[model samples]
Target: MSSYYGRPVLKEPVWKVPDVPAYLYLGGMAGASSSMALLAGLTGRQRLARTGRLAAAVGATASVGALVHDLGRPMRFLNMLRVVKLTSPLSVGSWILAPFSGLAGAAAASDVTGLLPVPGRAAGVVAGVLAPAMTTYTAVLLADTAVPGWHEAYRELPFVFAGSAVASAGAVGMVSAPAESAPARRMAVSGSVLELAASRRMEGRLGLAAEAYRTGRAGMVLRAARAATAVGAGLALLAGRSRAAGIAAGACLTLGSIATRYGVFEAGRETARDPRYVVDPQRERLRERESAGRGEVH
Candidate 1:
């Protein structure tokens, strides 16, 4: 039999991006802001803590709203609550988000009321722990999809997001906190460093998918991220940091982080749409299957 050129391509889900991108942005902000609130409370920045908590609460609410609104049938969103499928990353994520969101709301509310009970301290601490995980886990959730760029870059995605979340939250803190606070500077610096490292790791570890991060719009966003992270962190480390510098850097990091997410997701859509990613891998599998079949027959 003769083989034909220009074979037909297979496709994955065709998602309307408006909601997913917004959801990703909101979720990251919410998680990061919550982390900031917890840290501010610990460091005795009452005003910062109070403002940060309100910020987190609003962000979190927006996130949940975005999530449901993204679903065409918003009413059916409640169906997700009834299931527990460990193998499904979205399912696992929904579970993780439920309690985390509740706790974040409680913490934010306590800050507003000026009655953060000693017992509630335990809740805030727990929420603080869950906050980072909430941000990190979304990377895992995106990667779990049968999307090439996302699935292949799995190992580095969580770290990338973690660093981005920190930077994003730190930026918000910079807006709210006084410039001289050592903790805020440290957090921003830490986030910037981690984000830069994680981006490098993504470029290094993922050979093909890394191309997504390196070219066109993706490249532009990543390039900006690198520059911002490096410069921001460097300035913070040197001369003991300044509010203006920190704000600028944080803005860059926040923007860069958001762009990265969109770029990654877009690349995955491209990967899923392209015949090469699906065909080549499947062809290899078929060859193996044929060889095994022949061997069994013999």
Candidate 2:
């Protein structure tokens, strides 16, 4: 409730809009697309598999470009690779991004050009194996930060991100291979459910921190995301091979995923700008601890 001159106790995030948000969205889409590609290939849906590979390749490449652009230098990103630290989310994320970009690109190239079929499938498989971590590591990266909204929602953030990733990939599949996209539709529906549910749970449990997510610009964007995702899922369920419906659903789902990422990023920024979000929580924790100690002594 109190602060030095009413200034924020924590530094606001320096990440720029569109760059960091785009990186998060594209990386998540690529990771889930790779997994979808691997599964589709194994099931003999070659067209769907190829579509997934292409989507994953493009998304990964764009994601890395956005990240590098945000960093202001390619070398900064490279520096993250100098040492692998399990305790560092940024380090782990860089490693994941680097290999994922290569593998996804190679897989897509081979599938498109019909060259090195064996190697292409192998690369796709490896990328698929790393996809889950790729999709959710960003959540860890955000949650590990000092930002109140993100850190407080750590318990459900990964699930929210994973669901968004899956839905994004599934949307790609729906748009690209509508006729053979039963699996994609299923993923879209299930992922939307998970994303919506986890988001609700996360906000509900955040207590004071939830204000950042429920007010201002962050609130509007997040509300839009929820609406789009819900509508997209409904459309996916009834698409039934209609190319128009599939495309519409895919577009909505993609928009929803993008909105979610930006909304979360902005929420963290909002929390960091308000000293109340920081000071109030710490004070409450101290009070609880003090009360517990007194009771134990008595």
Candidate 3:
């Protein structure tokens, strides 16, 4: 409720639209697709594995491009690799992205060219090992910032991100592989459930900060994401052997995943542009601490 000349109390994130959100969505998809590729390979679903690998490669390459573009210089990204700082999410994320891109590319090339079978499989395995971390690290990176909406939702953001990643990967699988790829449909349904549940829980728990996610551009995008995901999940369940239904479901899920990333990004920006979203929760925390102190004294 307070402001300096009616201006925001915190500096808004300088991250640009499309670039940052695209990076988030693509990185998540790449990571989860790598994991799916690993699973498909182990299960002897070679076609699905190949599709997953290719998707991962493409997503990773584009994600890195988006990141470099956002930074305004490719060397700026390289500079982040100068030293490893475990305490910094940006540093950790940089390390994760670099290796993930290389591994995903190697795996995809091997799958497509039918060469370097041994090394390619190894790269896929390693990429799969790093996939979970890659999918969720962006959430940590966002929550580490001062933005009220993102910071307040830290506990659920990783789950939300991971679910979105898996759903996106599943959508890719469904679109590229045959309708017989039951694993893809299963992943879509499960991932959508997780994403929606986590999002709802995050909003309910955020109290005042949740307003950022429900009252503007962020709200509209997220509402659309939820609708798409839910409908896609239902369609996937009823798709059976219908290729058309599967494709439709996949398209919806993919859009949902994209919207989720953009919506969250916008919510953080919204919170940063408002003083109340920053001050209210902080004041609440201080009051809570004071109340606890008095209780202890009594």
Candidate 4:
């Protein structure tokens, strides 16, 4: 509304409501759970492994449904499979999602169906191999967009997303598994710390474009995310003493992780809605380049 005319440089994301954010959270949880399942299986923690596998499968399934729903039609998603687009983040992400889902499903099936041992182990390994990509490619997808906050914060987004994913998956494990599995508690605490730190660093580094994170609705949501993460992680550290505490910690962590996803999404949307965020950064970049050029001439 100021002198810049209030027109956004980038179109606002058409992906609305629960679909996009839900996909982000579910995909993250699925990826982390798949990794946990593989590690637990290798380490002979059968109960933890089974829980992780089932969680991974369910998360992956729901994530796929969310993606399809977001696409507006099932046919569009099918059409996406017609080509392997190396340059398109969504295309590559779609491919990565497929095998990871299948592998996770097979691993989960082996647990409930008792359908042999070797295939389940093999699927677990394959899913684990793809888990990191599954968790991180969405960061690249969002960063590739023209949105100012997302593109500017690209360096830190992957770490933030990864940490959130680990926290969410660990929350699932803590809720479903016995307290004996210390890895779940450790992962929740460590991941929460990492998520909080990375988000702070990202907000700090974005300069003027980070206004969305400092003010308005975006700021409020992000502050809540920070509070939830801190309390959840802190409680998780002391949760070992009591089962009720463990459940509470798990619930808090899961809520925090979901809040983190929605907060980041909203911040980027706010940045896209306001022209100043987009214009100011570009103007600054141009000014810096001009200054360097003048110095070179001198």
> Which candidate has the top score in TM-score?
2
Residue-level lDDT of model 2, residues 205-244, one tens digit each, is 9999999898999999999999999999999987775778
lDDT of 1 by residue, 1-298 (tens): 1124644353555556667776776677677777777878877887667656666667677777777877877665667879999888888888767776777778777666667666456666777777887778889987777777788778888888787777667666665665434555576678777877877887788666667677766577667667766666665554244667666655666676677667667767766656666556667779999999999999
Each candidate's TM vs. the true structure?
Answer: 0.83, 0.99, 0.98, 0.96
Q: State the weakest 10-residue window (summed lDDT) of model 2.
A: 237-246
Q: Give the clashing residue pairs of candidate 4, or none.
A: none
Candidate 2 yields a Cα-based lDDT of 0.95
Instruction: Give candidate 1 regions above 4 Å deviation.
Output: 1-12, 115-122, 235-241, 281-298
Cα RMSD (angstroms) for every candidate in the order listed: 4.0, 0.8, 1.0, 1.4
For candidate 3, the per-residue lDDT at 53 reads 93
Cα lDDT of model 3 by residue, 19-44, tens digit: 99999999999999999999999999
Off by over 4 Å in 3: none
Q: Which stretches of candidate 4 lie over 4 Å from their true place?
A: 1-5
lDDT of each: 0.71, 0.95, 0.93, 0.87
The predicted structure with the larger TM-score, 1 or 2, is: 2
